[model samples]
Target: MTAASRPVALITGATRGIGRAIASELARTHHVIIGGRSRAAVDAVVAELGDASAFVADLAELSSIADRAAMLPELDVLVHSAGLIGPHEPIAEVNVDDLLQVFTVNVAAVHELTRITLPGLRARSGSVITINSGSGFTSHPNSSVYSASKFALRAWSDALRDEERAHGVRVTSIHPGRVATDMQQELRAMEGGEYREDDYLTPAAVAQAVRLAVETPRGGNIDELQIRPQ
Candidate 1:
């Protein structure tokens, strides 16, 4: 099928982890656009997923995001999987720079990208799925900054859902428990413990949640989904 005729999905952080899995899953039915910081990495994933394209953009860099968003004509699905896990320090020890950086990527970027893409999404009656974390609803020791960013994300998703419902767009926040991705490995290492893959959910599992939200009927909106390891 020609690219113009197929449904299009743009997945940020598509180079690895849950983003990559979502890209792969959507590629079966949609023309996936792989969004990532590294062109080489995006290209590699595109090569792996035959029916996909690449749009390289670093969420941390604000200037280029607008330009990249303009390149997209219309988008059917916008999956926000690009995020940062800030320093795991107690509130007393948390660095201001670290907090700002985490919020910039996890919150601001998501908001701006959605804003820029709103027209296209509204035109297509699309779906927006954000990969929020279980930390969004609860906080643990030394996780204040990360949790705060996620809480902000949750608020954004909620507001967006209400605002876009009249336009026939679906907004969903997916809060997944610890996923056995490289990020989890890093978190485990920071805690000075062994990283066990079996202890967490796979990226594919999280990707399935995204697919379910996207595939729901236009009249049905799955606003929030929380998946945890059994």
Candidate 2:
């Protein structure tokens, strides 16, 4: 609660990629919590980010994520970095299961996590930051499912920002273009061709965006911020 004690920052999907980078950035300033669906990955991150603990919570399973948040240490910031970017599948032609799976993680899970963390967040006037996608704003044909899931995430985040303002809990969403991550690699594979990793944003840069959003004076809240690959 005071400057002497480090504020706690909980990050999901923090084994590798953006999640891992965010954990590193936050660790420099706050005590960190590394979390993900993979126990191995989370443990690895915990090792690298000392003074941090690990947890296994799959975002796709909303109840499991909610449970983790309920048991989290007093947190000053919660970063929702876990996500899904499946292969391109046309809307009407897309697999039903895939569509629901994306929403289950990217949308519903965030809401549940927030609800579970609400009390602590309100008490400390903490913040919730969600890792979003530019596709949430601009549409790409084959990306309908993924984009729609993120669009819903952005909407929920906006609503939460307004709703939690009275409680001093700020909600911020960072919409970034493709980042050079394993998720991006998986996405590229769907094209059945090699893709230029240099064309995408780096995980470190995206993590920097998050650090900036969280470290500023609590007086001003960035309801939404977008970062793109240049």
Candidate 3:
């Protein structure tokens, strides 16, 4: 297919980890646009994927997100992969600021970006995928803050799928369990556990799950997928 004919995909947090893998996978079939906080990092990924481009901005900033998203004339696929996981503490120890930072990046940004891109997605009968976590379905002892954000994300994705069904826009939430990324390593250290790559799922595996959801035939939608390490 020509450049104009190929599907367009914009993946956030694509400079590293699962987002990077997803970008690489979609670059095979879509004109992947790498989104990240660092211009250099986004540019690097764009170079890595010869057919890809860049969308650099801090997702926590709604105005920047609006400005960046407006540049796109149309989008076929939008993958929300950027997230923040932190303040692993009990409710008593957690503060509103911690909730604010986590929720801003994980929930609010996804909501904002999707809101701005709905027109493009509707125009193209596109798909939206949110890289959620198993924590979304269940809350752990000290990770309630992160879990809360993921839970909210899951709820939003569900509503989005329903709201956009008539517009021919598919929404999917992929809940992964402990992927072997830098974030997982940090989470392990925080939990006082040894970080073992062998025990965790690979980013490529998660990417494959995303590919499956986006590639599903148009007559159907993969509303939610939960992937865990075997």
CA lDDT of each candidate? Answer: 0.93, 0.86, 0.92
- Residues 101-131 of candidate 2 have per-residue lDDT tens digits of 9888888888888788788888888989999
Error in Å for residue 11 of model 3: 0.2
Query: What TM-score, computed on C-alpha atoms, does each candidate reach?
Result: 0.97, 0.94, 0.97
Assess candidate 2 and give its lDDT. Answer: 0.86
Clashing residue pairs found in predicted model 2 = none
Model 1: which residue pairs collide?
none
State how far residue 151 of model 1 sits from its true place (Å).
0.5
Instruction: Report the lDDT tens digits of candidate 1 across residue range 1-230.
Output: 12456899999999999999999999999999999999999999999998788889889877789888878868899999999999988899998999999999999999888899899899999999999999999999988999999999999999999999999899999999999999999999877899989999999999999999999987999999999999
After TM-score superposition, what is the CA distance of residue 151 in candidate 2 from its true location, in Å? 0.6
| Sequence-dependent TM-score of model 3 | 0.97
> Which parts of model 1 have CA positions greater than 4 angstroms off?
1-3
